[model samples]
Target: ESGVGKELVAKNIHNSSDRAEGPFIPINCGAIPETMLETELFGHEKGSFTGAYAKKLGLLEIASNGTLFLDEISELSQRLQGKLLRVIETESFFRVGGLREIKVDVRFVAATNRDIKKDVETGEFRPDLYYRIGALTLRIPPLRERREDIPLLVDHIIQSKPEFKHKKLSGKAMEILTNYAWPGNVRELQNVIYRALFLSSGSTIEPHDLSPDLTSGLTVSGRRLEDIEKDHILKVFREVNGQKRKAAEILGVDPKTLYRKLHRYGIDD
Candidate 1:
């Protein structure tokens, strides 16, 4: 759900997994360059290439007997996907230049924001690899779908903040968060709350603490602004509780203005 928290869900999964005591390495596959991604994941032997001054352990080796979280798994290249499949199937791999194969035991938990099935149909992703990793699929619903969970998520974010102390969300602020689309998902909501926290000077947050993106109506002319604001607001909201007061203050807005919009949206008090 838009207002739901991903970190919370991830943490819950980690705690429940059998490898709870072992290291939990999380990597965003989409963020790294395709060229260096293999090296980053599987590591390279010393003198393997131009930059190989010394031997380095890949995340796979480091996460041996642990949990390896590959976020945005859909971004993996086809070649990389093939290599990964081999590793998963054979339970062994060789370093970039090393002749000897290294074996390891690691549980993989991958996630992606995109429709993986569509990626496969487009030939952008490998279907075999998908089946290998997605043995236990968990589809997290968007925030807009789970309206009831918004309030709880907001409270969780607010309490998680270090500086908020005893601060909390107002009814009006909560309403705005509950109604938002949250296209960026939990990560976006977290950022919006954080921004709101910084903008807030008082003990409680208001809608003004929210980013302008939340208030700006979507239009043909303002589409980019709307997107930017939406992303920012969702991110901040994720960080702070859906409290409009906190969000508004972080966004540097008056609480009254934030309250009015909540009413306009028809969000329940």
Candidate 2:
């Protein structure tokens, strides 16, 4: 889901909009550590803390006259969520320790891979913030669902990379790529192609050059929704060792729902 190029879509929108020439700052919310996420977004002043040797500007400042793309936004903590809401409401924020508030004109574009419907319902994500960020939403389709675009995408990748420019995919390899489920979507495809090119000296790529996972679909790939859900619930239960609050938070389910599921699955305390 991450490799699905959400930022690419956001860039496309910005490039087509009035902010075409302005900077586009993209931040992956899930990649940053939870403890430092706030400071990363709303930078600190010099001597703000032990490591504050010099004052620094945050992403918001960097994208002041441009677009601020927040990827994996669902990973933000509730405290940061409230802070972010305040920034959105005021269009201004203070440096981590400085008293002065800095204002900016920025177009915010947030993306998430989570099940928003479930997250909002479970109270894991703030509904007010959700409405604010999702005022304009666009969903990108996964690669497997767009089989017709494989050839064009492959061509684009091949031509884009210098090492891959001279190489071509064999008919069988291309067919396999086009038909594969592509669990990792376009990003995975790019990786496979790059790997295949790196490993082979020949001008054409073959099926063996690609990852086996692509050719031999896993048995779990065809499982029914209910079976998958059961497996996931069990996995989460085991991961948290039956800690209801933690499990519910991770599963994006309320406590009562988690309790009912525990009873349904007969999971002991």
Candidate 3:
């Protein structure tokens, strides 16, 4: 649900709507700290707080006459949720420390992988705000449910990568990808393609070039997570030609951590 390309859907709607000319502002409610969420959404005046050096526009004002996409909407604290409800009702909100209420004409689009009903039932989410945001709900099926799109999505991802423009997935590789349960969804698929591209010896990427982690989900089919990690490290080692720095980046870790893992895994690289 997290990596089901929900942002892409939001963007497509914005681009096709009458507000296409306006900015499509997207905010990840869960990513920002709760303390800063207010200022980030409504903006703060110069000297509003310690770091407010100049008058700044909030995302609501920025998306005036446009679309404001609040991703991970359920993550918004109750206070922020109440404030957001007021904005939806009045179409105007004040800056964090500003007295004046700024008016904006913007459409709101919210998304969350969490179950809003359950959250609201548990009092974690406000009913008033929930109804406001959930006026129209569209469910996006997971990648496992829509395997038909994998090849097309794979092609889209591969061709977009300049280095893999000429690369193609071998039949066995495609079979493996098709059969595996993508717990991480499209995002995981993209990573696998990138990893395959890195390890590919020719224009065609084979099954062995792909990360074993793809199969790590199914206990009966794939190796354990540790083995997947080991194979992944070895593949990355070969891909970067022993460049620890680059390999670390590709693996999403610091050089020191990468070094320690390599040592722990008994990898020379």
Candidate 4:
């Protein structure tokens, strides 16, 4: 789900909106440590803490009149979630250890790879905050589900990179890419293409240029356990058109086991 390009979608929304002229700021909540995340989002005032040298502006202020993309927002702790909910409800927040409340007109776009609703139900996420951000939701399917977009995406990636300007994917290579179960989604495809570009001797990328794990079916000696299982299950699931029972039968596993695995892998249906 991560490599599905949620941030890209968020940036597109921001660019297409009235705030296109304004700055589009992005932050990964899960990437930053919890201790620093609060300061990063709300900033700090001079003398607020040991390292607070000057009045620092938070993303909330910097993204004023624009969009603040909160990627992996589900990773926010409950305390941070409450603080964020308050700001969302009031459109204002105070700088860390500051007396004055700073206000900003910011469009929030949140993304997560987890089932946030389930998180809320399980009490891991706040329900009120969920409703606030859930006013609109968009689901981007994994690459394997929408194989039609592979060629276009491949072309886009190729054209975007100057080094690969004259390079092209061979028909067989494209076929292998189109049929393979992309467990890593678009990000993986991008990496594979980039690797092929570098390893390719000529202007064309061939099937053999792809990584062995991606091309070879005879061996799984070097592949990660989860990756192999994910690929096999996804292949069977797709073959059965997402019929869990049939897939379970083919996989020699129970329907519930198959369902649990699919859910764990973030596969829809």
Candidate 5:
């Protein structure tokens, strides 16, 4: 759920809406410290606080006439939740340490991986805020549930990387990706693709190019586990310009072990 492309969905919504011409602002509620998050949302006047050297506009004002995406909204503290609820209701808020209330016309898009209903029941999140934001809910399924989309997502990711423009996934490699349980979702898949591209010998990404964790105990191209290990060792060795110590560090093995493996694979140097 963490890497299920929630922000992408929010962007799609904003781009297709009437407010497409306006700024699309996004902030992760969980990432910012509580003290600073308030100022970030409401802005501050010059000399409003110790660091207030110049007037500043907050995300609320910046996203006026547009969309404000609040990622991980459930992480907001109770105080901020109350303030946000007030903003949704009144459509006006004062900047930090400013007396004049500022009005904003902003459409809010909120997302969270947590079970917000449970959180609200447990008194962690405010119910009033939840009701306002939950009017229209869109649930994105995990990668494993929608395995068919992996190929399309993979292609999209590949096309985005300039170096991977000429690279393509082998049929067996694609099968392994689609079948693997992607607990980390699209993020993990992207990382795997990048890793595979770095380790792959040719234009095609084969099953052996994938991280060992993903292909463990799985045979493809009728290659034995030892052969897979040999191929991986040789690839790492070459990628590091035959620097055994660096290759060993990358492979998480000692230099002596890598040397022994190289010898066993009948590879000199």
Candidate 6:
């Protein structure tokens, strides 16, 4: 649930920490590729390897005397966990293909959506690394747990959207949004609002503008092929603003597939 608020919290922690002047580099570990993750975080020296045309500094070196925010820290592989432990313990690392050891002064602030303690117990994650990273831990409760924050978050989201500046949510729509169990968390809420913003022609966003997927709960019963097809088509349609060409570009599908979906869904020109 690392949303706008979580980022703000991270920023506040960094700003208040001793190394306020240093850079605060935020990395989403879960999103980065396993192969490139090392290179991306710990930069390489020129000619260190193929495609290493120029010398690059790693985030750890760049955040010298600063804070490094590692989001989704649990996603790191066992090898990466070992490397990270070494860096944390020694505050030094050798750049890929570089001979010299580079020292850094950095405070790490990591966040994760997984149970790291369980990971450590299961031996998927190193216990020593866990102890190093958890010098300070802040647990951010999910949106459902903090129901009182819903209205405030919704208002902030609406105000943040440029297209929805003039639009307002009807009381009923607002109620629906507030009461719904937000499984996707704050990110899902933002997407729902954005969807409503585009779909609503009037100044007020209504319940009808929301995607059926958001409201409809998927059951254990196997979903129909037609239902899956419709969902995919609808998603692509919304992404491209009902444009066949742009939808094709985004979906990486041929124009014919997009056209077929449009026809299949009975979407009018």
Task: Return the top candidate by lDDT.
Answer: 5
RMSD of 6: 16.1
Backbone clashes, each candidate:
44, 0, 0, 0, 0, 1
Candidate 5 lDDT by residue in tens digits, 7-80: 99999999999999999999999999997999899999999999989888999999999999999999999999
The lDDT of each candidate is 0.77, 0.85, 0.88, 0.90, 0.90, 0.80
- Across 85-199, the per-residue lDDT of candidate 4 in tens digits comes to 9999999999999899988799999999999999999999999999999999999999878988999999998898896799999998887887777888999989988888889
Number of the predicted model whose TM-score against the real structure is largest: 4
Per-model TM-score, in order, reads: 0.73, 0.76, 0.77, 0.79, 0.78, 0.72
Worst 10-residue lDDT window for candidate 4 reads 218-227
Ranking of candidates on TM-score, top first: 4, 5, 3, 2, 1, 6
List candidate 4 segments past 4 Å from native. Answer: 218-269
Please tell me which model should have the higher lDDT, number 1 or number 4. 4
Candidate 1, 21-82: lDDT as tens digits: 88888888889998788998999999999989999889999989888888888989899999
Cα deviation at 220, candidate 5, in Å, is: 13
After TM-score superposition, what is the CA distance of residue 38 in candidate 6 from its true location, in Å?
A: 1.9
Alpha carbon deviation, residue 215, candidate 2 (Å): 3.0
Model 5 — which ten-residue stretch has the worst lDDT?
216-225
4 or 6: which has the higher lDDT?
4
